[model samples]
Target chain A: MKEFELIRKYFSERGPKRKDVVLGVGDDAALTRVPQDKLLVVATDTMVENTHFFPDASPRSIGHRCLAVNLSDFAAMGAEPAWASVAITLPTSDEKWVEEFSNGLFEVAEYFNVQIIGGDTTQGPLTVTVCLKGFVPENKALIRSGAKSGDWIYVTGSLGDSALTVASKLNKINVKAEHLEQAQRKFNYPVARLAAGQVLRHAATSAIDISDGLIQDLSHILNASNVSAEIDVANLPISQAVLDSLDEDSAIEMALIGGEDYELLFTVPEEQKGYLEQNATAMGVPFTCIGQVRGGDSGICLVKSGQKYPLPNLNGYQHFSSEEN
Target chain B: MKEFELIRKYFSERGPKRKDVVLGVGDDAALTRVPQDKLLVVATDTMVENTHFFPDASPRSIGHRCLAVNLSDFAAMGAEPAWASVAITLPTSDEKWVEEFSNGLFEVAEYFNVQIIGGDTTQGPLTVTVCLKGFVPENKALIRSGAKSGDWIYVTGSLGDSALTVASKLNKINVKAEHLEQAQRKFNYPVARLAAGQVLRHAATSAIDISDGLIQDLSHILNASNVSAEIDVANLPISQAVLDSLDEDSAIEMALIGGEDYELLFTVPEEQKGYLEQNATAMGVPFTCIGQVRGGDSGICLVKSGQKYPLPNLNGYQHFSSEEN
Candidate 1:
């Protein structure tokens, strides 16, 4: 398909027009009106073959993951996604792939009420980069530097299922049929905790999305907040699917250090703990208290049976690390 | 180097925190405060190796062009660039290439006062995509649908030199040393007409950046505006360097349909022509009156000596075109 025709058929037809989007895709640049009292949150994420995804990964999964990861950033900032642009580089212009990819992208975009504003298509290896623009009230954004020493650390939803799915795919590991599908689905369409983030904005002091493993990513929040954390391994949110497929120790380790979960990890003040628990229940999202923020040299630790144990130096998803999968 | 170390050494160190940027890179995401009265202009462009640029092109030039093309999108919207995020995919972590690329990116970014805020890096075939976010007064953005019949069409700077430079590079066409350098520079670092765009936002009825050659890209504006245009071939702006290097016929054809000249092509009211001309002169940017918008006729024509000639039917830079460079 020609570039213009491909764009019109797939992307241009998918997004809903909004009043704030004065102009959208098919223009040289998209025009969006930002309300005077709001701050704009912008973030970009790129997925590449053999790096962010498997070479043979489904196009739908790729598109879903690309936008989902970016939305995770918005969740981190306590912002609502308003508009997004996708720049896709492909080895070839395959109509079926484009159709599926656009469907995947628009599925999530429509859910978030985000307009597909602008994009570029080019010839190259398959890579998808999406820039998401969101809006938040002034001074309402959650930042990594706002956590206090006495804040309680928490994570929404379960973790490690995506990592387990990756392992199963790579080794062709045969697990219980239902558990296998559940793990794979979690890997393919990890949801960004946008609702939880919106509620936590009022109570959380610091926030981050788990793209890297929980331990490493939470370390970023700790380091930025200038505090240390002690996460109870038993309290870590491990999915039943992960637990069914592996031993408790291995499942807990994966939950702590496995990447691509796309859940939000945040810190709430001690005084607001009750309010947070109540609000989270009202929101219908599970929240687990895993640790407490403490002042000192900043690092993460694991607590077991009321005894503190130093965590291993194994950093999560360092890109260059030679750690075995 | 590790991914985190590489990110800190290059991207994190270059962009200083600005007032408008409430939060910058190094966190989970960047947060910025946008003026309430302004419309936010957003654009994304991707450059791929052996596709957008030559495989052997300098990393600095690659970086510069990557950012420059996105800036051109902002220029098309008549917006002042405020912030940008870059997502790069590389085959491997080459420190030297990353250094030069980051340097080139920062040079133009600093010049334009655009802060580099957040981005993602991954492993893949070499690709760079930059998402530019800018601010413009609400209702002041230049749109492609604003042109009307009888409007005067104007372009900033000469066209086709960049295409000629690409030809020269590929064929090793040895022109005058100065001409070769000028052509190469044009191909490498075509400046986005940001200031002219800002000034023309009110004056120009419609606007677009000439990326896919003049004839093809102008068709987009015409299609969007529901108008056609008539060009005076004799008055086409061909730089002396391009004319000196190629025959007049080839030069005219290149100027008409060659792509990658990051110049502004816009339409203004007939009454505002003199004002635009004077403003261009004051800004030290060239203003060439080459055409006039007309009723939609489904085609562009060239008028020479009061005789109309049908323009050649070369669709600009079609990826599937059999003419493989």
Candidate 2:
């Protein structure tokens, strides 16, 4: 365990230092101050080897994606990420592995202005858990239960690229050389859509990050809001990389049910639509309207090119399943 | 997959509902409020199977001990624990295992008035990570750096019982039948001296929880305060359970360097010693003055019956060590 000491040194010395952090990293606990008018928001996510990623996955990507996923959750709630606590369990404390992992982790931490306050590093099978804390203005957090029946459903950025990347690696689909890099980048280095979420806090009725695919996550909003939704498969945002790798139905299916896309899925009411469209540039991401919210509790109904689309047999990634998709 | 839903349902429906939690468990992130006059305290601890516990360690004990260790960190800081985010990675979703684990977790949460705000559950090797958030009055935290020369060194409660239990399990010692259950309980359900920590916040110059043993943890205070210490081995507060199971020398060794005791090791200036003694009843634990802080950084100097005592050979528990002691 000298590695333990080294690991602590690596974390304590690196990363952004926030003024609100009265103390950071070295003590039994870190002490911080939250602004008086803001509510603290907390989100946690865990990635496991052979379950969330491949055994040969790059340490950098693992580090980046684990924190990215949690930040995306804060984004969904329109929270400004402030601090993070990471718990990493690995089989060995390989110095090079930890170095690269820290690089990937601190890169995002610095960019998001999130201070790595405290964490634990233990020896075990590879697993990374990040708990993110942020702040949202009082009564300003976007939540699933707030969606109304007449709101227009929208998504930020393109989807399916990350899922397509996973499919390519599993040999379920073959990706072209020109498109492979884009797909891999989309999967490994996801943008959390923080700016868009902040923009949506004023205009959107409800919001959720697309972690468990569009349909599954939209179902969560529908369930919470007691409303139904109709998503137009033809209008689903699919990147060129996804279109080139698979057929139309396959691309649509990937966008609807494949997981790990960190884009925001949100709904805007009729009165807020103009406000959203007028300030589109402020969102920092392209937005597309894919459907509309409907009355009642019928769940999600799919439509494509003016026709009803059949639901796919496969579901979004189920974490506890014996096998990964 | 459905088990994931069931697991989520279990956590969302149980635990103490706290007024400070604006939103918890079901959303992308939990929302909480921190009182204006307090600084937020954050601590994280992870427990991995085979490393932190045996394969057959009860699910209930695992859950309780995992959160207990983190809460102990809060206790050391004299913080009022408020919220927690738990990330649990397991090989399978055994209903009984999860049920018992939740029971144990909720038991501590309810007792401490800490709410389970958010968490993630994933499939992997058995591991549990807990991140706890609390509040402390500004500048009132008992940090390790405040110990001063000539300060009285004190420890709350008895030590070595937890370590003796581990030694017995490893066949290094034989525990008397009368003391076996007490030793196991002390190891499994070690109490965090929250009340004592609060009392010391006003009087003690520095403090730390004894997760890493008396010598190792006391060294932390010495190093941070840039001061040395003389610990009287004869005055160590060892439990009857420890004394009954081991010889005098072995018992002292265990008390000096064994880990997981979770008692408070603190230093009080000469001026505050009277205040501390007068508030001993409010501390809610028996405390012993076992040593005194010295000027300069010569590290810890051990003494027994007024003669210099040799340091023990064993070191405290290191998380990344290959073999458990």
Candidate 3:
């Protein structure tokens, strides 16, 4: 009937069992044992209704997206997600909505073996803030600053699909039925490449998960590592949905500026290129070489049809600012 | 600048250097190393505009309260506060508000040596959600279900000040100048009682932080331990602000039903009573014995001058529900 009571009934008591969770929901805090040899990985993300998602967004998809985004962070670091805490606010106490939301949350959590541990439920506009924790071996965590000149840049899975999903959802573009379905699935439940991330731990020189557009997110690695990048536009991984709905130039533009892909963008040194490709493929996640880390202070270029152009000055979908891109 | 750029400038680059933070806030996720012998403690709390704070409330205070509440959860679990991630949503990108918020957050964080690890900044109605991670020794973490009959119930710090602050701020009651200042401090920056929690790990049989009022929160401990408790009204720790503003009956009611004290409510076995008192004092936190646990399937009682009274059919400050208390 009340917030706490409803939470314990639907979330706490029903949460999947995990041996490492020494304590779960209902306590002031959840206690979990971290394996001694690993470092703890933490990331938090918030999804605001009408801002991050449509007002009519399915509770399940919203829930899945909230956790998937956080898992994407772990994926970038080559970490295995272990636990999660959610602080959700709602305008009203609708039991059905709450159930659906938790169902969506638990669905992805269960699939990933991430335990839903502790969080607060409050009254307000609908917002879901999820904080996830995972672990990686000491000194082995992938970092953006490790990119080096001569490293081969790679990304997991195709890009532009999620961006196309948003475009189609807004009716800004016309997509075929199958393309729409494919876009919607990618839009709602873009999988986190956990296994591929783990495999890249030893192979990739540096890594980041693509939440912002490929261009903007890649620039972070360039800025952090003090290196530039040369992306072969033709080599960009274009999703079939986008390929079917848009021209080559528009799809490439979408891949560069469109975000929410939750795919890993990483760099591997020349010597480890073969190792990374083989391992990523064996993990059953697609891997594509898109660019090369170059020896420059700070610049990015797009090479297409034998011409090189400076990277577009478009900013990705930054949540709380202008949307000039 | 975008949300990410603003965050990097104000929150990340400016965050204190903490050794346990293997990698700080620029990566997809922050990496932290938990001590080998301890289990990770996690809790999340969100402060929503209007529901949790006034629209014009001080940003610094809001920031302080967000982390303080999460730290309170750690205190109840006998965990050492360590790292925190904040997911803050804003109606717009106001640089002044962002700076002040980070100031308040870092102020409290620095006091406890806690690290500001990672989080997301987004556009939406103003909301602050904080997720904290602490560490508690394996098998020594306190829980509500550990209480036993005959255990002495104790609470740390004075209570009802925060409630008085809310009442005075809303014009429901009048508090004197000095008392208002005291109440405001308690309202915005209640201490987490971390040291007291650590000491209690060796002495307290069960513990919980007082959040959703004394009566209801204590009932959680009773229900979990399959026991009941009787609180002597005279022993309830009333703050000067509350005493100055309300009559004895109302003050007692506030103490029982006005939550958000962020103080520890704990039970110590008969033999460990002296140990708790001595250690709590040594840790510079006051402790008062308010009641005794009793063997029962489910019940709570109140004692006035010597007579046992049935626990009031009163509800505390439950969000998204009736306000009949």
Candidate maximizing TM-score = 2
Give the per-residue lDDT of model 2 (tens digit) for A42-138.
Answer: 9988899998889999999998998898889988998899999888888987878888888889999999999998888888999988888889999
**TM-score, each model?**
0.95, 0.97, 0.96
TM-score of chain A of each: 0.95, 0.96, 0.95
| Model 1 alpha-carbon drift over 4 Å, by segment | A308-316, A320-325, B172-174, B313-316, B320-325
Per-residue CA lDDT of model 2 for B1-325, tens digit only, reads 3754765666878888999999988888989999999999999988999887889888888888888888889888888899988888888777888888988898888889888987888888999989999899999998989999999999998989888888888898888977989888878877778888899999999988988778878877898899999999999999898888788998898898888889999999999988998999999999999999999999988999899999987533444632100
Candidate 1 lDDT, tens digit per residue, A84-109?
A: 88988887889999999988888899
- Stretches of candidate 2 off by over 4 Å are A315-317, A321-325, B315-317, B321-325
What DockQ does model 1 achieve?
0.49
Task: Answer with 2 or 3, whichever has the higher TM-score.
Answer: 2
Prediction-by-prediction clash tally:
1, 0, 0
- Per-residue lDDT of candidate 3, residues A234-284 (tens digit): 899889899989987888888888888988999999999778756756656
Candidate 3, residue B168: how far the Cα is off, in Å: 1.6
What lDDT tens digits, residue by residue, belong to model 1 across residues B169-212? Answer: 77845578888788788888878888888889768999888888
Using lDDT, give the best candidate's number: 2
lDDT of 3 by residue, B1-325 (tens): 6776788778887656888888878788888889988899888888899988889899999989889888888888888988888888888889999999989998889888888887888789999889888888889998989999999999998999888888888999988999899888988878888888889889999998888788878888998899998889899999878887889888888888887888899999989977865675655688899999999765788998999655555744464621110
Per prediction, fnat is: 0.60, 0.66, 0.64
Ranking by DockQ: 2, 3, 1
User: What is the Cα-based TM-score of model 1?
Assistant: 0.95
